[model samples]
Target: MEKIARQGLLYDFYGALLTEHQRHVYEDVVFYDLSLSEIAEEQGISRQGVHDLIKRCNKILESYEEKLHLVEKFEQTKKLAREIQSLTKAFSENRDMGLIHRIEEISGEIVELEAH
Candidate 1:
């Protein structure tokens, strides 16, 4: 995955674990696309401080992902869901028996993932 997109996914899955100030700074940096200097100006802190906070927040978010794997599971499930959608669309268009079997297989995989 791209760096920015990976950061967003990590944040989405683990952001709630961050302290309030960390969360604020992180949201500005990642979600709002604010530069360090810009965030520092808004928060009345030094640019280096903002930069350090962002780095720390990124570390914390990544640590959570390493332990939990929520983002990984979500991406896998999303891919499977999209595949099922595509297969279903094809089946609808041409009534292909093969597509139906593939759709069922993928749906079973989804169910197994949910069990975990």
Candidate 2:
């Protein structure tokens, strides 16, 4: 995944791990689209220092995702949720018991996947 995407997912799950300054610098540079020089000027740090801090923040975010696998799990959960939604729509529109039953089965599978 891209650094920003990875950081977003990690932040959703574990943002409290970062220090306040790290959080501010990271959010400004990565999410707010502030230029490195601008971020350095705003934060009273050298541009190189800002660049390095952002790098370190990226590493920290990536490390959490790698260790916890939250991003992967969330992706899987999202796919399963979509499947369930589709099946629910099919069940409502078509009234196919077999399809509904299949959806139920898949829902069971999703629950089982979540349990681990």
Candidate 3:
């Protein structure tokens, strides 16, 4: 993934674990696309401080992902859902038993993933 998109995913998955102050700064940089200097000026901190804070936030969020794997599971589930949708559409269009069987299998896999 691209750096910005990866950061956004990390933030989405683990942002709630951050302190209010950390979230504010991280949102400014990642969501609002603010420069480090801009965030520092607005928040009354040094530019280096803002940079370091962002780095620390990244590390913390990544640590959460490493331990929990929620993001990985979410991505896998989403991909499976998309595949199921496509299989359903194909079955509908062609009345194909094979496509229906694939859709059923994918749905079962999605259910099993969620059960865990």
lDDT of 3 by residue, 1-116 (tens): 88889899999989999999999999999999999989999999999999999999999999999999998999999999999888888877899898888888998999999889
Candidate 2 local Cα displacement, residue 102, angstroms: 2.2
TM-score of 3: 0.96
- List lDDT for all candidates, in order: 0.90, 0.84, 0.93
In candidate 2 the C-alpha lDDT for residue 58 amounts to: 76
Q: What C-alpha lDDT, on a 0 to 100 scale, does residue 107 get in candidate 2? A: 79
The deviation in Å at residue 84 for candidate 3 is: 1.0
For every model shown, the clashing-pair count is 0, 0, 0
Candidates 2 and 3 compared: the better one by TM-score is 3
Better of 2 and 3 by lDDT: 3
Residue 68, model 1: lDDT of 82
Better of 1 and 2 by TM-score: 1
* Total clashes for model 2: 0
RMSD of each: 1.0, 1.6, 0.9
Leading candidate by TM-score: 3
lDDT of 1 by residue, 1-116 (tens): 88888988898888899999999988898889988889899999999999899889889888898898889999999999999989888888999899988988999999999889
**Candidate 2, position 109, lDDT:** 78
- The estimated TM-scores of all candidates read 0.94, 0.87, 0.96
